[model samples]
Target: MPPTPSPSPGAPGRPPPERRTDDPSAVPSSAVGREFAFEKRHFDFIVGLIHQLAGIALAPHKLEMVYARLARRLRELRIKDFDAYCALLESERGAEEVGFLVNALTTNLTAFFRESHHFDHLAEEVLPELRARHADVPRPRLRLWSAGCSSGQEPYTLAMVLASSIPDLRRWDARILATDIDTHMVETARRGLYPAEAATGIPPALRERFTRRVRENGDTRTAMDDQLKRLITVKPLNLLEPWPMKGPFDAIFCRNVLIYFDRPGRTQVIEKFSRLLSHGGFLYLGHSESLYGVSSSFRQVGPTIYRRV
Candidate 1:
């Protein structure tokens, strides 16, 4: 696929109709006395800032969500209004608050095995190939990356597949790098625990083998076992920034992450991934995402799965 130029703000092309952040007609009379009125200007500033910082394209209609999440930061900082909060963000020290804002605004909905098919593909197809390719080496070295590993489920799932696929994993050098832009999410993933209900998507035997039952503050939960924990490392990472690791990873799982980015941003990330991926490596994206017209670095090997060309 040929590379495309990034779109200018308010570009001439007829873009998709933006979903509005709020409905004026739906506003109740009782809500009129609110202290801070989130104006169109404030929303636009936020969208631009987030796009600049994280390469995430905030839809125009997500104003309500932006207002609601950032309101807590405003309250914490005792900022008088949305205008004042935005002005603060525009200031020099506003850089410090960027992480807080991102932590609050970014979505982190994930599970032990949210997309079961991806794991199945990894176990049945990808892992066997990796094992066969590395079989000759005494201590086979393998690396996998989970780019938007929200709360660590994706990497842990990958680790589970590795554990099940390869016999005598202790003799091999395997590592899964799990990273997220949200510091809070990275910390949560580092803790390696989840509510019992969050384990529903996990297969019964895998769940039994990997998570140990536990209780905290009268709430029953599950924690990743040592075997899974040893195979993974959780770190804070903003995908827009430079990555510190020099990796030729065997597989890179970046599912659902590109949905938040504009076309050019998506293309840029894919190209970067292409450079990081080893020959014949795999790239797994979300069901809704595709490589079509984005990059020719990969060939579609399955639904939402791509192999490096």
Candidate 2:
């Protein structure tokens, strides 16, 4: 009351020595607030960790892209910072979180009969040769693996090729094992419903054989027919995880999946694919990818195809 005690120096009337909250730059070195601000060090650590855990390399320039995808998880968890979220990833609950990260970061760019040349080669050269080779073997069986098959296109393409080219597909034990790291993609592939645009490049004959049209509320819709759908089995597969399908496959289509992996990661995956292939089996990579520097286990058979050597 005596002039409010003259508002004593550094007292209630005055600001409290520019406290951390009021001036972030003035925060004590030990205060966690200073560390909460985004730092390049933390960014690099996250990028490296993602590469290690998922074989998906998030380049330095993609720091914003990573933040855009993962920030939602941070918010959903009520986490105000990345450090705490990263630490949480080290725990058992982190497994699910890591799965989300992997799914988000992976590039699932794929379509029916992508790299059309591969399908042509399969129909004309590979399948014919396989049939001729197995003609003498009773109950001819063929196994093809579409590793990193996103939303069923590659495997569905494989099925279409097999169904069209194979003379006695009904009698043959032919199957395609389609897999991807993303569970959502796997489930979508299993549904076998594709937009009409997806069938644009599909040859008319193949489309007729593999797809059926239905009237959906006054609109015509096309979907993969039962026969083709029956030929492929979609499953969730993480290339970073242990191989679940026992193989000796006639061919393995792993197109476009390795571009995200570093040299060592790519090499490890190639080696595993080589082991899965039957002797003389073919391995097809994406047009932009190669096994040349990555592995010596496979010999180049075509621009994007390899033979287990």
Candidate 3:
């Protein structure tokens, strides 16, 4: 009999294809990249560590989501693996790395007048009440804080409401202090530019008064009109850090930001917000969040809206 031919590489008759290791550190070139096999341990460690450090709790089920968000940082920093990335997070240069992590991990879902009810409350209830309280005061100034203000929408919305509803806004010394942990967002808010879609829910009269249309690439950019823009001053603020503002704000819109924080962090933030607010001022949380049992300083006034008692 002629010599039996050895089975060709990957031929059916050959020994079965070797199983690939699913481990990220051991994946072969022909196998899918390690990014997809991001270790659950790594994810758990990072999430737990972040929660411990900053009180941001990323759930265990968010492993894949977290990997997708932070994998780019690994590539950008030329790091080899998640472990190495975690090491970088622990180093002396960790502050900037942590910032990148925060930027990547934090959800920034917002639009102009999102949760329109809050704006309605601001216009119909809060602002009127604030004005009435200030009526007897000599200066009659109104101060609003949009804490964790993402890309400026909430603060800008507040400004528009004030401009439209408050007479003599230019003379009243009214101000909206909009702050976010992300510098990029702060700068974007400061620019006061938004895509036209952001204007959809805004009333036509207010849109006309508060937004100016400019064309670029045959698309319009709605620049917030000076009247509204002048009311908001955007700044970079870290909720985890000591607050820079000395505030006795009439109202605060800290919507959607506390979802990332754990119970203790949320409580701390609520206490801070309560302290920042004037007696009888308001605190607006995200629609999905509530202040029940979080702090004694606020009394629930509506769904996700609280009054400082």
Q: What digit string (tens of lDDT, one per residue) describes model 3 on residues 238-275?
A: 67667778888989999988988878779889898888
Model 2 vs. true fold: TM: 0.81
Stretches off by above 4 angstroms in model 3 are 1-37, 136-138, 216-219
Which residue pairs in candidate 1 collide?
20-61, 21-61
Q: Which candidate is the best by lDDT?
A: 1
Q: What would the TM-scores of all predictions be?
A: 0.88, 0.81, 0.84
Candidate 1's residue-wise lDDT over 1-309, tens digit each? 112224357522222233364866443344376556666666777777777667788886787788778877888999887767776765788767767877887889887777788888988998888788877889988999999999988888889889988887898989999999988999988888999888887889989988888999999988899989999998888787778878899999999999999998898899999999999999999989999999999999999999999
Q: Scored by Cα lDDT, where does model 3 land?
A: 0.77
Scanning candidate 2 in windows of ten residues, the lowest lDDT window is 1-10
Residue 106 in model 3: shift from native, Å? 0.7
Model 2 CA deviation exceeding 4 Å by range: 1-39, 72-84, 213-221
Model 1 off-target regions past 4 Å?
A: 1-35
